[model samples]
Target: MKTFTYRTATDTAGGLEPGAAFLAGGTNLVDLMKLGVATPDVLVDVTRLGLDEVTSLEGGGLRIGAGVRNSDLAAHPAVRRDFPVLSQGLLAGASGQLRNMATTGGNLLQRTRCRYFMDATKPCNKHAPGTGCPARQGDHRNLAILGGSEHCIATHPSDMAVALVALDAVVNTSQRSLPVSDLYRLPGDDPSRDTILDHGELITSVDLPALAMPSTYRKVRDRASYAFAVSSIAAAAKVADGRVTDVRLAFGAVAPKPWRALIAEEALRGKPATRESFLAAADAELAAAEPLKDNAFKIPLVRNLVASVLEGLTS
Candidate 1:
């Protein structure tokens, strides 16, 4: 551990130093620091910036501030009524005490819980790029199956992000606003970089569009509580007269970022809301997956999860 200076940031700009990291909730950052994965020389406390409000948008949408805690967001009346998927996703992660401290932006920015990434002794491309990824040949039963590169196959650990991606949420940062899909980048050649944010940039809020349809989030994990997802699906569908009118899907614990199932959505549009259609659409998307040796079960796991989520939505 390194000695560091601590300061409280009153505003969004002009407080960030060269090696400073914003601290809202230290749930993930503190863990990484203790593991020697992150060593910052400065800690900027942004918890009192007054960005914790969950306000209603003019057009029935919702705008959640970055500092809003996960527990509050999940239990908000508007969120529970309009975006049940997001609520379910938030509740599915961590524990009650941790969720009370975890913020919206912090949750979105949480790094992978990969054992290799956390182990400073191991060689992980995500922890130290160009070194090598031991999980590629080591214990990778809980790693990624889709959107992985030769350099890294670490799965993202955020359940809220998966739901937000499915809901087409936009991330508002101090630098610029972008879709949640564009917020995270796939590990192509640079596994060290987790997001597309520049240094000193800070997330301010997240905007979620109003969705008036059946939506759900489901996670399959090693245990029932306080466990990361082994395979998860966040889905929303609008079915009318036994045919799918519109649909959106995003997968978690299967890629570097939330795997938006655009191909599956395209295949399901205007198709009958039947088990066969769901299976075909799932197969269409899972066909591109390249599962590793130990994680091959994720191929069928994701396929069945996608189909089951859509089936439940339609029913």
Candidate 2:
């Protein structure tokens, strides 16, 4: 690891000094630093900035401070009652100890679990641009199958963000407010940049809209607990009298970011909430998947997860 300076910010202001990075819970950042993937010249401690509250908004919305702990957020009564998917996703990620230490903003900014990106000796375009992405030809059973590029194929590893997408959550940054969906970016030709936020911008809070959607988060992984998602689904459906009135679905561990299943949602609207309709809707969204050698199973995994979760939500 590189020698670095550390400081704490009393207020949210000013662009980051060159080569500076924020420090919240340090759950992910510390690990990356140890692996040599993140080598910042200075660590700005924002844990004391007082960004750790969950407040009810004026319009029945909920505002979550970026520094709020994962475990606390999951246990919040309002979250469990109004945004079940968000709470469930938070509980499903990591282990009990990690959930106690992880922060909402840090969880949203997790790096890929791709091995190549972590091994400093390996050639990974995401770690060092133009070095090449060996995962394309190597072990990529858990990498992205959608929104990837020749430059990289790493999947975002955030269960919480997937649920946020389904809830139409908005991210509030020091710069501006935008939909949580717009926060992430596709790999395209540049895989190093995971989010569209300016390098100096700080995420302050996340806002869940006034509209309510009783939803759930389901994750399939290699193990029963403390495992990264192999394929995960966050789904919300509105069905009345055996007909689908509305629906929302988002996928994780199958794309570069939390993928909104827009096609599937569009297909299921006003349609019968039956097994056949669910499968067709799932298929419609997955038709564009471009899986590689080892991860092709993700396509079917995501498809089945979407169908099954939507069925449960509707039934």
Candidate 3:
């Protein structure tokens, strides 16, 4: 490994300095550095600053410190009981040892698992600037077709993040608190960047608001567990008087970000919770889906998964 300056942060406002990257658990950053995907001049270790904690907020929301380990978050009794989606998502990733070392913040910032993005030899906009994206035309079976531009086709890779978006979670940063929905940037003109966070900003915590609605996360991949998603759905529904009052739906692997299917939610709200209504809502969200030649199956897969998730939520 190349030598680099390293420091331990003392406070949240502590400077990371230009050309320096914040180190939480080093789960993702260290791996990227070894692959030559990220080469920072300095690494500011924030693990010593005591940001690891899980606290209940005044309302029904929960506050999770950035430094909190994945294992802890996944196994927390409160999380397992109140936010099973979050627990389920985390438990579905990596191994027990890895989850113990991985931090909540690092997981959110984890880059796409796209093969092109990870392989230095391949042409990927996310890995090399202005080199162009090969996945757009070459191999796109596992890539994102929605919200993708001519520059890139990589999908965001975080099962927990998808659940967080559906739960209306907010990300607290050193600079400012941003909604999880607003954290990701669409791969439009710049596919190299995944989020709107500026350089040197450290994620402090993730705050989730009170959700009276029923929520669930459903992920499908080639492998049964510990594999990246091919298509997944995170959904929350509020049912009253046998009618859906409100709903939140986010689809993964189909878009550049954890795509919130608002059109589908709108269609389901105030409607009877039935298989037909659920399918209609899923169709509304995927109406504009433009699938690639090899990955056209994702269109139906996402639609069916969304329908299934909503169906289960109602049950």
Candidate 4:
């Protein structure tokens, strides 16, 4: 690891200095530092910045503080009742010990779990741009199938962020507020930066809009738990008289960002809530998928998962 200055943040302004990185849970950041992937000169601890409360919004929604722990957020009565997808996604992520420590903001800021990116000795375009993406022809079974560029094929590793994107959550930062859907940037020619968040910008809170539709989260991994997703789905659907009134879907572990299946949502909006409809909708969205050699199975895997989840919701 690198020697760096550490200080508790007094305010957001103090946390925004050059070459500074926020330390909330340090569950992900500390590991990267140890691996020599991240070496910020200043580690700004913002755990005591009074950003740990979960407040009810004036408009019947909820605003989750960035410092709020994943365990707390998942256990909140309001979250479990209103947004079960978020709660389920949180529970499906990391182990219990890590969930107790991982914060909302830090969870959203997690780097790709690609071995090449995490292994400093390897030549990963995500870690060192213009080098090369070894995972392209290597062990890329868990890498992205959608939104991946020739430069990189890393997958975003957050289940919570996928659920948030499906639920239309808004991330409030020191710079500006934007939908979680727009926060991530696709790896085009440059893969060094994962998010569109400006350097030193502090994420204060995330706002969840009141969604009336029923939603759920599903993660497919190598094991039942404690494993990163191979592919995951966050789905919300509203059915009336056996017809799909509305729907929202977000895919994880298949893209550089939590991919909102707008095409699928559009396809299912006024269609029947049946397994066939679900499959057709999924196909519509995946028509644009450009799966790599080792991960071509992701196309069928994601399609079947989407169909099954929507089938359950409608049934």
Judging by lDDT against the true structure, name the best candidate.
4
Per-residue accuracy of model 1 over 1-315 as CA lDDT, tens digit each: 777889898897634768889988999999899889888999999898999999999888999999999999999999999999999999999999999999999999999999999998889898888899988889889988888899999999999999999999999989889999999999999999889998888899999998989899999999989999999999999999999999999999999999999999999999999999999999999888988899999988988998888888899
User: How well does candidate 4 score on lDDT at residue 214?
Assistant: 91
For each candidate in turn, the TM-score is: 0.98, 0.98, 0.96, 0.98
lDDT of 1: 0.93
The parts of candidate 1 lying over 4 Å away from their true place are none
Q: Backbone collision count in every prediction?
A: 0, 0, 0, 0
Worst 10 residues of 1 by lDDT: 10-19
* Tens-place lDDT digits, model 3, residues 1-315: 567898888889745677788888787789888888788899989898788999999887899999999999999998888888889888877778889999999989999888888887788888887999888678888888688888887888888888999888999998999899999998887888889988878899999888887778888999987778898888888788989998988988888899989899888889998888988988888888878889989988988887788778888
- Model 4 C-alpha RMSD vs. true structure (Å) is 0.9
Off by over 4 Å in 2: none
| lDDT of model number 4 | 0.93
Cα lDDT listed for each candidate:
0.93, 0.91, 0.86, 0.93
Cα displacement (angstroms), candidate 3, residue 287, comes to 1.4
Q: Please, what are the lDDT tens digits per residue for candidate 2 over residues 1-315?
A: 888999998787636988999988998999999999999999998888889999999988899999999999999999998889999999989989999989988899989989999998999989999999999889999998888999998999999999999899999988899999999999999999999989879898999986555699999999999999999999888888999998899999999999999999999999998989999998999898899989999888887887788878877
